[model samples]
Target chain A: MDGFWIILSGTLIAISCGLLGAYLVLRKMAMVGDAISHAVLPGIVLAYLFSGSRETIPMLIGAAVLGVLTTVLIELFYKQARLQIDASIGITFTWLFAIGIILISVFAGQVDLDQDCVLYGEIAYVPLDLWFTASGINLGPRTVWIAATLLLLILTFIYFGRRGLFITTFNEEYAKALGLNVAFWHYALMGSVSLTTVVSFESVGAILVVAFLIVPPATAYLITTSLKPMLWLTAFFGFLSSLGGYFLAVWINGSIAGAMATVAGIFFLCVWIFSLIKQKQASIPFRA
Target chain B: MNDKTAIEAHNLTVSYNRRPVLWNVDFELPAGQVIGIIGPNGSGKTTLLKAIMDLVKKSSGYVKLFEQDLEEVRERISYVPQRESVDWDFPASVMDVVLMGRYRKNKLLKRLSKADRDLAAEALEKVNMLEYSNRQISQLSGGQQQRVFIARSLAQGADLYIMDEPFVGVDAATEEAIMLLMQEMKKEGKTVVVVHHDLQTAKLYFDWIVLLNTRLVASGPKDQIFNEALLQEAYGGKLNVLSKVGELIKEKDFPVREK
Candidate 1:
């Protein structure tokens, strides 16, 4: 039962990451997600300092806001200073993340954060945090509910605003010309991505969070060209990777987050090999 | 609508990093005219279009459509940017591309209506691409892709259409189809402004010509302005000798003026 809850929660987190990751991949903002994932540490630390608690809600909110701010700052630098995007992302996130590292070292004794746990979470123990009602109805870990609710919100937004999101991602200028508030849509999408990243941070950790956000969708992109199909495939790939990685972790006595990321990498490799084989086969001559 | 100028640019100047690209360009296209804006590379032809559309910020000046500011009158004007400006591999079909044109009319949070779908189909039909409506945009040929973009503009259903090098990378048949479509739009009393590169087709297609070389060299009826002197001026004064010879004949009060 505990293992079932762990897999379920991990699957929910993966789905949330996949849902927001599709737009990030389409916008070519995958690296920005990586940067934000790293850069949110300081916000998390600061939220802990201010609140004097390790509650998930405040830390997630703080981290999400900082992530959005980081994205905006990157855009401002790109637009106003004419800086290259990669350079901007590297400069902004590295500085913020370094500051986070400094803060964590300075306040090491007081805060519950450790460098190892921030980078790779203890996913094996997540199910141990599950709570039950008076009737012993298991409610699962809090991360599961948070991830599920975030996934639902993301799916609802995508379902209703699919056309707007499609146009905005495909050609922002055309969307603006068509009188769509493209800037609003951009920020909204980025905010959703940041929110998902921060909320899933505890379950997946910061470093492996990027693999969850980028790899599944990227694998889906390799297999399909349509957005809707790619999204469905990405969710499926994410779920499969989570399940496979959980079992692989149990088999190898490895970190669940690391195992999940390894499984995603393996899935990408399989797709790459399949595509190469298909291409090679297409080039061969056939005897009648 | 037929009598008023569809587009009017007044003293428009655009620059990049203090280097002027378009200089004090003033022009107007009367409604229902198929006008060609002709200029050499780096002669501010595309810059003029971008400035008019407010895509690129102008250093100084204003553009008006039907006597209203460009932003306020945006819905009445449709712009088809250069084919190279967009990623062809973007995950959208031809029909999806066309439906983007109707986004302005649809309310926020509202899905595309059945009428919008029919309009998209009809626009694709006008470009002879109704069959390719469901195909991914990257699967289309270069000419077919240009037609799809033209269909997107057509779906906008605006009074004025501004196209930037719609003929680039297109086959001759596609060019002729686009020209015929422009003529049809003219007959329907819609103004079509095209940024043309081919000099040979300039005289064959456009009824009105605006010769630009970082400025408005001349703008008027094609027959009146499509002459050696204007072409020389627009081609960066290479034909200045011919103009000088005509000037000498006028000074000598000679007849015929060198044909």
Candidate 2:
């Protein structure tokens, strides 16, 4: 029962990450999510300094503020300084992450954030710490419920704003010309990504969280060019990786989050190889 | 000439990095006219279109659509960017691209109505691309892809259409098909502005010609501006000498002079 719940929690988190990651991938902002995840550390540390507690709500609020600020700062650099977008992202996130690392080291003894917990999380122990009571049923891990709710919110946003997101992703200039509030959409997307990252940060640490945000959706991108299929495939791949990775972690006596990330990496590698083979096969006839 | 001018630009000057691309470009098109904008590469033809569409920031200029600001008259205008400008492998079908035309009219959070779909189908039909509506964009041939873009513009149902090099890299048949569609648009009292190349077709296809070489060389009826002198000024002038001299200077230490 414990193993089942553990895997279930992992799968839920993976599905949520993968689904939102699809939009990030489509918008070519996958690295932005990575940057945001790293940049949120300062916000987390700041919230702890202010509130003196690791409560979920204040931490999430702080993270969201910094996430939005990171995006805005990147945009500002791109627009005002005429810097290349990738460079701005790299510079901004690295600086913020460095600050976070310094803060963590300075306040190491006082805070609950340890070095090991920051790199790789204790997801297997999540079931031990958090409990959920839904109606008459008692759930083992609170992470599962939180991840599921976040996933549902993301899905609803995507569903309702599908056309707007599609048009904006396809051609931002065109969408703007047609009077779609592109700025609003962009910030909304960034905010949602930040929210997801912060919510899942406990169950999966920042590094594996990045893998969750990137790998599954990227794997789906290899198979199809259509947004709908990519979304479905991303979710499917994420769920499989989570379940498979949890088992693999148990088998190897390793961290569950790390193993799950490795599973996603393996899936991405397999898809990449399959795509290469398919491309080669297609080119063979032309060569002949 | 009709009293209704479809597009009017006043003192349109655009610069990039403080380098002027267009200098005080002023022109107007009478309604229901097929205006061809011809220029050598980097002659600010595309920049002129982008500035007029408000896609590019102008250093000092104003563009009017139906005597109003472009933003105010957006729904009455359609734009078709160059084929090279977009990612063909983007996850959209032929119809999906065309359906984006109706996006301006749809309410927020609303699915594309059946009427919008039908309009897209009808636009695709205008370009003889109704059958390819379901096809992925990358699967389409260059000409077919160009037609799909044109179909998207047609689906906008606007009175003024701005197309950036619709015929570049397309087959003759596709070019003819696109021209016929443009002709049809003109016949329906819509104005079409095309950024065109191929000097020969300039005489055959366009009714009005705006010859540009970094500045407005001439703007009038094709018969008035299509002469050898204007062509020489627009295409032959100092650019050839500058380029030739530049290349020679690159290879040799001294300037090259022709005998």
Candidate 3:
């Protein structure tokens, strides 16, 4: 039963991140997700400190606001200050993340968080946190519920905003010609990434969250040629990584989040090698 | 020329980082002619097109399409940006990209109807890309991709089509095909404005030409504006005296282009 909940949480987080990750990967904004995941640290810490309780809503709001701000800052620097996008991303996230670390250090007593919690959340503790009714009926682990809700929200956002997301990502200039609000779609995706990062951060931790946000989608991107199939394949790879990571962690008696990220990396490597071989075979036959 | 103005710009100036790229440009393109924006590399031909499409901010002046504001007539305008501007490795098939043309202001939240898909297919057929509709954009050659972009613009069903350097890197066959398509569009009374780089083919391809070098040098019918003095002004002293253009301007039969 405990194993079921742990794997379920990881899988839900994986699918959500993977779905959004596909867009980020296609946009060449994969590292933006990583940047947002780290940059929202200060917002997450502040939200937690303000709420003074274990709650998801406040943290998500903080993440959303900070996430949009991070993108806005990146854009401002890239456009206004004439900085290259890569430099803009690198500078923005590092500055915000540094502030988060300072906040944690300065308010160590009030934050009351173990270094392990912030660094790489312990996934094994997921089943330990349970939500119960007033009638004393145990529904399930609170972490699983949070993961499920976040996934549902992301699914809804993707479903309704499909058209806008598609054209804007494919061709921004064309979309601008069509008079579509390109900025809206851009910030919407960024806000969602920030929320996903924080929600998954509580149960799965930062490394695993960043890993799922990029690796599975990138792996799917390597093999698929179109968007629809690429998305389905991303979800499949996300689920596969979760299941494989659980077993791998149990066998090694090591960190679950670490094991999950490692498995995702392994999948990426194997797929990459297999694809290179396929390309080589295809090219050899066509050579004159 | 048609009674309706296709594009009207007055004192249109665009600057990048406070340095004006397009300065005090004034011109009015006719509704049905094939117009070319011709200039040197940094002469702001693309900037002029972008300004007309409202892609860049103009420091002064404004552009009117069909004598109305751009916002009121967006659907009547189709913009084909530089072919190399978008990432070809995008996760979409040629058909998917073409279908985006059928998407509009009103259909933002709904699925494209069967009629839209049929129109997209028809556009692909016009470009000889119908069979390659399902092929991923990443798998296409430069010419094929350019054709797909034209197919998308065709699907737009717009009155005024603005293309920026559409023939920059295409093969000879693709160039011929595209020229034929443009002629067909002209026959159908649709307006086309292209930012052209090749001087050798500019006169033959465009019915009218707007020469630019920071400021507008001249804009008129090709026969009226295709003079050595105007060309010299637009190109500064960079015009090659022994080039084919000089011979053509002198009304001498230059050697036939190698087929």
Candidate 4:
């Protein structure tokens, strides 16, 4: 049962991140997602200092504000300074992350936040945090409820904004000419990424979050040629990785989040190699 | 001609990186005509179309469609950017791309109705690509891809169509199909503005011409604008290569002299 809670939590994070990551990967903004995960550190630190606790709401608000700022700054450098997008992403995230580290050290006397907790979270401790009602109702682990709610929110966002996201993702200029508000969809996506990062951060940490944000979608992308199948495949792969990651962690006596990321990486490699083999087989007839 | 004007630009000046690309371009295209905006490389032909569609921020100028602001008549206009502008490797099928043409009509959060799908299918049939509707877009040939774009815009059912380099790399059949479609649209009292490069086909395909060399050298009926002097003024020394190859004729007597 404890293992069930942990896997469910990991799977929920996987599904949410994989769905959003599909669009990010297709937009060539996977690195942007990575940049946001790291840059939201300052927001997390600030939220902790202001709220005096690690409550989800204030931390989400903080992360959202900083996430939007990070995207805007990246765009500013890419457009105003004419810097390449990768360079812009690199420069912005590192600067914010450095500031976050500085804040942590300076407030070391007051804040109990440690860098290790923020960077590589321990998922095994998920069962320890349980949510209860005033009437003595036990709602299982709080992380389960949070992950489920986040998944529902992501589903609603994707469902309502499907066309807007699709058209803009496939072709922004065409969508803009048709009078669709491109900026709104762009910021909406960034905000959702920010919120998801912060939610997953406590259990999976930034490292595994980044892995879920990129690896599953990339793995799904290898076999599929359409968005619908790609999304379904991404979710399936996410669930599989979560399930496999737990037992692997137990067998090796390692970190569960690290094992999950490693399993996701292994899935990606297997898919890539299989695709190469298939491509070679298809060309054999042509060569003959 | 006593016809209504479809597109009117006044005092249009566009600059990139502080250098003027299109300066003081003034042209009024009459309704129901095939108009070609012709220019050499770096003459801002694409820039002019972008300005009309309001895709790029204008340094200075305004473009009116049917004597009204673009905002007032957005649904009446369809813009097909350069075929190379988007990634064909994007994970969408032929039917999916064409369905995007139906997007402007449906309100946000509303699924496309059955009528929209029918219109999309009808548009694909018009482009002779109905059979490929389920195929992934990446599997398409260059011509098939161009046809898909045209089919998408056709589904828009707009009064005005603006295209950038629609014929640059399409097969001859696709080119002919697009030409026929343009002619059909003209017969329906629709206006088309294309950024064209082929001078030989320009005279055959367009009724009106707007020649540019960073400025409006000429804009009028093709018979008036396709003359040697206007073309020489627009192409500048770029015609030297064409004359040296002597593909057509009259190299020695024209502006093809080495300079």
Q: What tens-digit string does per-residue lDDT give for candidate 2 at B1-259?
A: 2338888898999988899999999988877899999988789999998898887889997988888887778888888888877778787788888998888734868877889888999999998999988888988887998999888888889888989998877777999998888788888888999999667788878899999988999999999997878988998764456865664564354123210
What is the per-residue lDDT of model 1 for residues A78-172, given as tens digits with 9 covering 90 to 100?
87788887898899899989999999999988988865664445567677777688999987786677778988998888888787888888877
- Expressed as tens digits, the lDDT of each residue in B1-259 for candidate 3 is 2336899999999999999999999989898889999988789999998898888999999999999989988998999988889989888999999998998876788988999999999999998999999999999887899999999999999999999888866777899999999999999999999999777799999999999999999999999888889998998877885654664553333122311
**TM-scores for all candidates?**
0.90, 0.90, 0.94, 0.94
1 or 4: which has the higher lDDT? 4
Candidate 2 lDDT over residue span A35-98, tens digit each: 9888878887888878998776787787878888898888888777888888989988999989
lDDT string, candidate 3, A90-144, tens digits:
9999999898889889998898755455545678899999999999899999999
Arranged by lDDT with the best first, the candidates are 4, 3, 1, 2
Task: Grade the docking of candidate 3.
Answer: medium
The reply for model 2, stretches above 4 Å from the true place, is: A102-120, A132-137, A279-288, B1-3, B236-259
lDDT of 3 at A106: 93
Where's the lowest-lDDT run of ten residues in candidate 3 chain A?
A: A113-122
Decoy 1 TM-score against native = 0.90
User: What ranges in model 1 sit over 4 Å off?
Assistant: A105-112, A118-120, A132-137, A280-288, B1-3, B237-259
Strongest candidate by DockQ: 3
Clashing pairs in model 2, backbone N/Cα/C closer than 3 A: none
TM-score between candidate 2 chain A and the true chain A: 0.90
Where does the lowest 10-residue lDDT sum fall in candidate 1 chain B? B250-259
TM-score of 2: 0.90
* Model 4 TM: 0.94
User: How much is A37 displaced in model 1, in angstroms?
Assistant: 0.6
Return the DockQ of model 2: 0.47
lDDT of 1 by residue, B1-259 (tens): 3348878889999998799998998988778899999987789998888877777788998888888876777888898988877878876788888988888635757877899889989999999999987898878877898998899989989988989999877777999999999999999989999999666789888999999999889999999888888887888664456855664565355223312
